[model samples]
Target chain A: MLKVRLIPVMTFNGVSLVKTKQFTNARTVGNPIQVARVYNSRNVDELVFVDIKATEQGRKINLPLVKKVIDECFMPVTIGGGIRTFEDINDLLGIGADKVLIKSKALQNPEFIVKAVEYFGSQCISIAVDVIVKDREYLIHQKNDEKVLMKTFIEKMHQCNVGEFVVNSVVCDGMMNGFDKILYQNVSQITTKPIVAVGGAGVPSHFTELVQTNYNGALAASSIYHFTQYTPQEVKKNIE
Target chain B: MIVVIDYGMGNLASVQKVIKSLKKEVKITCDKKEIQKASLIVLPGVGSFEQGMKNLNDLGLVDLLYQEVIQNKKPFLGICLGMQLIMEKGSEPNECNGLGWIKGRVVPIVNSRLPVPHLGWNNTYKHKEENQGDTLLNNFYFIHSFHVLPEEAVECTYVDYEFRMVASIEKENIFATQFHPEKSQNAGLLLLKNYIESYA
Candidate 1:
């Protein structure tokens, strides 16, 4: 049987690994390649690298950085952050990225998801839905004037034949309390797509609890090395 | 030299890197002449079956590869979509014909209630008769929605997941895996090493 995967997500700013608070106040942690090598040795299920500023800065994904990471690391790596067009995804996949995450652009043009799925099997594309609560309701109102309901966006993407989804909690992001269980459960209820619960993972039991709810994977950034002594191995053992 | 077929389908870099790490000479190219002179061939892919077949056909490699792998009996290995392309036909992206090297049809994995793609690492123990004290064909990284149902089930060496899906197939002079050995850490590297170092 395929076990539930425990993924360690490293946010990058150019070549340096950085930590952010609700997607702001970036602080350099270390070299991404170096950090990836460490995770590789740990035998984690997979890895995710998000170029936090790529979309906002209006640039493409860091290809060299992705190449360097996949060179040393021997697991499936998903690259995200500045994926805006089909060419960006093509270039990333050409360099050996196992999966590419699309966020802002998908929201602007939902049709891109359909096209991407048509070209590169649905398994290769993951949609990252950044969500925050507004007026006591969870909504996908990012920095732009455009907005869509979280529930509606998920249904639309699923209909578009999206392979998986990364339901990011903008309100709980970097807060380190725990995951937005409500959000994850709600999304999981709507679609059977692989839900990688990101943002606000503070401890091992947090992941343990998420797995009990049938969440496909748990993605941790700060909790792995910053706030806890638990390694991915330890977390897996805990759940077992 | 071992030639890794570059049909403009999947990432051939990691495949080349893994083979090189095993202290073996390897080359990545689409030229039919280079493929003709190679001692061994590795076909790696991770995209649509239709496109994968079209790329080989466009490069004029289908007939040449048939002569080399089937007629010449050169050791050939396919990975992921490459493995799927070995089947008689595939039902992905469209109903497309394959290289027909193996008697099988590639279809989506529907028996397992788990996610469609069946991503992540899983253990693949060899069948009882082929177990033969070799552990190289154990755990590997798999990422695909469709799997091959070969006419000769004995060709399959490993199966896992909820439905005992086909994981790795091996016949005389030909070996292919549904999982990516290059990305499968030590177990995968050892499998590649065994393929290159242990001649048949």
Candidate 2:
């Protein structure tokens, strides 16, 4: 009786919360803590907070901002962006983060994912696979403007035994159209790990459509709670 | 005071925050003296069974917890890894011995065609018909790969994920759950409140 999860993905720019389109053209949305409080009231399944600018700024996600957000909500929070070492993971978890999302670091040094799983256990460590579709193929998108075959990256990380995979589409980000079925179909062929599909969800049916296909969860940013009139609870009702 | 035992495994802060919000006196400590002074003890953890036992042993908390929970009969609650550690043995990363507080063995969930780490919310049903109205029977968040199989009949609640899996257990002064009540929101908060009111 495992229920599919509809999680809200919050993109932060170190200080303020922002929403991105295609992983660029960041637009400041609202205060991080206030957004968290609203989600808390709605009782969303889980919350994913990524400091989009942390990697470019060469620092970890703003801890004070994260701590304040954690205080405002009493649910699972996944912290990501600019995580380079084990200390960063420990610091985030110490401040009440349920799981640490590793993106750039996991690609740079895959060994870190193995070590992280060995030390913190698979339940606490999740990897975010940001991808872009090119020529009808998925490519692993990196901040340094390098792209690798998505299949190769996913197969390699699957061997590390991480808890879950967050398959996010950089091209479809903030588009509010719908999810990329081909992207999910491609990743599903590689591994059976729990997947949280991210990017390009415009409506509640968009979530239902993805969940009915393959993903165990759907993560949204600009749809439902952000840009539309539907609340998370209302979306959950639609899914149910 | 309710003492949340900290063995450096999982999110102790969220557990502390939830208990604090309930307006109950709570403390997160591994100190022996503080534990002895506590009116109730809560062990909340998230990790593998082997590592959890290792950390508890290295911190010299194994014996202390045994004395307080088993011998002294102090009201005790174990969450996730905490609940699994009460079993006599577990086969997660490898075969390892547990605290043996309960006569059971922890093993990978059976008949679950779903993912390994069965992560998400699921509805739980009370084992006893009379306990159908139990607040803990509501949907709760769970994130784990293993479940316990008690050797003896104990009051329990179960969730069906291809098979009936133990979700929560209750014995005289011991109460434990495989799901995280802290992260479960309203249903979770109500469960904690019920536990505190019944024991503390």
Candidate 3:
């Protein structure tokens, strides 16, 4: 049987690795290279490095740091955060990134997804949809407070030939409670794309629940792996 | 020294990093002389089959590659799109001729509940009869929409993504894996190490 992937997500602010609370109150975590080295020894299925400050700071992801992470880790690396143009994706892939994640860029220009898919194949492209439930409705959040319907955004990306998705919940993001199951199921139903459920993964059972719910993979950040309980191998054992 | 052929396609740095981690002298180049001097050749690629073939042809490496692997019997390994290029022809990104080293046809993976690219980790099961009790069972990362179907190559291992698909193959001096061994953690590294040590 194919194993359910347990991915450890590491967020970066420029060059330093940091953890966020609902996408704010960013706290320094550790060196991204050192953190990735730990995950490398844990036999992790994959690693996601999101540069949280890229788009907001009006600069591209730190390619030098990306190279450092790629050099230290052997498992497949999926880079997210602040990817704007095709050249950025191409440059990253060239330097050993297995996949590139697009968020604000995709929402800003839907055609970017089409062009990216055409240029780099859908397998290498992933979109991270950050969702927040506000006043009895789901809204996609980015740079602005502008509210974009989750279903509509997903539908547009699906049509653009997106291969995988990371449906993250802004409300549940630094809480470590558990994933927003209802939102994930809804997004999964909308498209057949492999969805990586992120945010609010606080325990080992949370991983099992994700596998039971048929989520293609589960991503956790500050919850179980911040030098807490359940290493990646332990979580994989629990999921199995 | 292991020479990783670079033809303007795919991630060659990761391959070089892994090989270096293994404490082996490795080089990434397109120079024909370097390829000739290396003890083994690794063709690692990811992209359209047509484009990959065109790059090799453009670099004028097809004949040198054939001479190294066939004439010299130097161990050769092709990974992902590189593996597909070993076949006689590929159907994706329009039909194009391949290296014709292996007897196979490259075609799109049969549609299933899974997406077309077949991304993520998958269990690799070695053939029971062909098994030599080597460690090939650990999970390996896979991300390809097309697969190679060889006519006469030995199917060392296989995976069932709704259908029985070829995972790895072994011939006289050639070895190829559909999965990205460079990206497949410890098991993948072990496979590469085995190739480097055993296939001479």
**Which structure among the candidates has the greatest lDDT?**
2
Off-target runs (Cα >4 Å) in candidate 1 are A218-220, B128-137
lDDT of 1 at B200: 24
lDDT per residue as tens, model 1, A186-228: 8978888877888887778877777777666645545456546
Candidate 2 stretches with Cα past 4 Å from truth are B128-137
lDDT of 1 at B14: 80
**Candidate 2 colliding pairs:** none
TM-score of every model?
0.93, 0.95, 0.94
Output the lDDT of residue A100, model 2. 90
Could you give me the TM-score of model 3 versus the true structure? 0.94
Across residues B3-30, which tens digit of lDDT does each residue of candidate 1 receive?
Answer: 9998888678789878877788889998
Which candidate gets the maximum TM-score versus the true structure? 2
Q: lDDT per model, in order?
A: 0.82, 0.86, 0.84
> Which tens-of-lDDT digit does each residue in B64-152 have in candidate 2?
99999999999999999999999999997899999999999999875536677778888888753324465334879998889999998
Error of 1 at B187 (Å): 1.9
Report clash pairs, candidate 1. none
Candidates 1 and 3 compared by lDDT, better number: 3
Cα lDDT tens digits for candidate 3, A54-149: 888889888888998988888888998778878899889978898898988898899989989888878889999899888888889866788899
As for candidate 3, its interface RMSD to one decimal place is 1.4
TM-score of chain B of each: 0.92, 0.93, 0.92
Q: How do the candidates rank by DockQ, highest first? A: 2, 3, 1
